[model samples]
Target: MKAGVFYGTNFRIGQSSGGLPIIDNDDIPIALVQGNRDGVANPANAQETYAGIQDPPKAFITIPGANHYGITNEDNLIREPNRPTLEQDVAIETIARWSALFLRGTALKDKGAFDYVFNSGDALDPNVSVESVTKPIPEYTSVVSLLGLGVIGASSLLTNMQKLVKKST
Candidate 1:
C-alpha cells in the first residue's frame, strides 16, 4: 500500500509557503499514529488532521500513556517535556505490530491483515485506541493478486517490447 504514515507530526494546509493540499485529496490510504501524551505536536491537532481526511481506508491510532518520543528508544523532554506512563519497549512493540498489520492489510492485500487493522482484531490491544474508516474488499487468493494485476500487466508489456527490440536488432 502506498499509504502515508504520520507519527506525532502536524502539517499546515493552504498556506502560501510549505502548505499541502487537504489530506483527503490524497489517493492513498493514510494512517496517523499519535501518542496521547505528545507535547511536541498536540493531540488535538492530530484530531483535526484526522477529521480533515474524508475518505475510507484511513486510520487514527492513539497509544495511551505514550509521549511524543515514546516511539523511539527514549523520551527526550528537552524541548517538549512530557512523561510517558507506558514503557519504551511496550510502546515500540505496539507501534511496530500495528504498523506492520496496517501495511500488510493495505499493501499486501491480505484478508487477515485487513481484518486485524480495520476489523475486530484491533480490540485485542488494550493500549491502543483506533478510529478508522474502511470498506470491504475482495480477498486476494493468488500470488498474482498479491503482486497486483496492474504491476504484472505492466511488466509483461515491457518484456514483450524488449523482446521485439531484440529481434529487430
Candidate 2:
C-alpha cells in the first residue's frame, strides 16, 4: 500500500511558461490529518486548501495542543518543566484508524474513535469554535502531480540542450 504525508502550509503554482501564477488554487483532500495548534501548517491554511478541492471521501483530522514537530514524538533530552507529555499513542491510533477506513475500505464505523481525536474542542483556545465543515466541489481534477513531472522533464531537457550548446561553443 502506498501512503503519503505532507506537513506544510504554503502551496504555490506556476504558469505554463514557468512563471508563478496569481490565480492559483489551494486544492487539498478532505482526508487530511492536521494539528489545530500547528505553527507551521496552521489550521486556517489547511482550511483554505480544503476549500479548493473538488472531491469527496475527505476529512481533516485536527489534533489539539499539538505542534508540527510534537506529533512525531521525538526525544526531548532537556525535559523542560510543565511541558505536556506527547500523546504518541493517540496520534498513532488516530492515523491507523483513519488510514484503515480510507485506504483499506474498513467497514466498521467508529464515530467515537475518529471523533475523539478530531472533534475534541479541549485542545483549541476557548475563543475558537470548531469551524463549519464543507465538502469539496465534485468537479475538480488534480493536475499538479502530472504537471510537476512535466516541469521536471522539461528542465532536464533544457539543461541537456545548454550543455550541448556550450560544448559546440
Candidate 3:
C-alpha cells in the first residue's frame, strides 16, 4: 500500500490524450474476494473499508482455508497447513462463481440474482482474518518492489557517474 492506500489501489485513467480533470469516482459496483490466508483486507477490515466506500453497492466474500493469494494454484504457499483445513481449489472456484454472478447482476441490474452478496457485512473468521475495524486494512506490501525502485535509480546514477569519469579521463 502507498501513502496509506491499500495495495493495488493506485490506479489511473486518462482521456484520449491522458489529460484531466481526472474522474476518480465512477460509481462502479465491486466484489471483494478475501483470502482467508490474506491477512490484509481480511473480511472484517474489508467490511470496514467497504463501508467507507462511496461507490455503488458491493459484495465481499471470504473464502475459508486460504491465504491472500488463495485464488492462485500455488499449493506450497499455504500458510500453516497442519492447523486449519486448506481448501484452496474451493476458494478459487468460489471467487470465480461470485465474481461472475456479481458482475452479471451489476451489469444487468439483476439485484435479485446476487442478493446473497449483501451479506458481505458479516463478521470475518476470528482466528485467521482481522476481527477489528480499528486496525489498518491488511495488504500485501511488495517490500522488494518498494526498495527495488530506489536501488535501480541509485544504480543508474552511479553508472552514469562512472561513464562520465572514464570519458573525462
Instruction: Give the alpha-carbon lDDT of every model.
Output: 0.80, 0.46, 0.48
lDDT for predicted candidate 1 compared with the true structure: 0.80
True-structure RMSD for candidate 1: 10.2
The candidate, 1 or 3, that scores higher on TM-score is 1
| Model 3 TM-score, all chains together | 0.46
Model 2 residue 67 distance off true place after TM-score fit, in angstroms: 1.7
Q: What is the lDDT of residue 119 in candidate 3?
A: 34
Global local distance difference test of model 2: 0.46
| Candidate 2 residue pairs that clash | 30-58, 30-59, 31-59
Worst 10 residues of 1 by lDDT: 12-21
The top-ranked prediction according to lDDT is: 1
lDDT of 2 by residue, 17-101 (tens): 3322232223322345555655555566666664544443344555554445444555233532223233656654544554454
Clashing pairs in 3: 37-66, 37-67, 37-68, 38-67, 38-68, 40-138, 40-139, 41-138
Q: Which 10 consecutive positions of candidate 2 have the poorest summed lDDT?
A: 12-21
TM-score for all models, in order of appearance: 0.71, 0.42, 0.46
Top-TM-score structure, candidate number: 1
Better of 1 and 2 by TM-score: 1
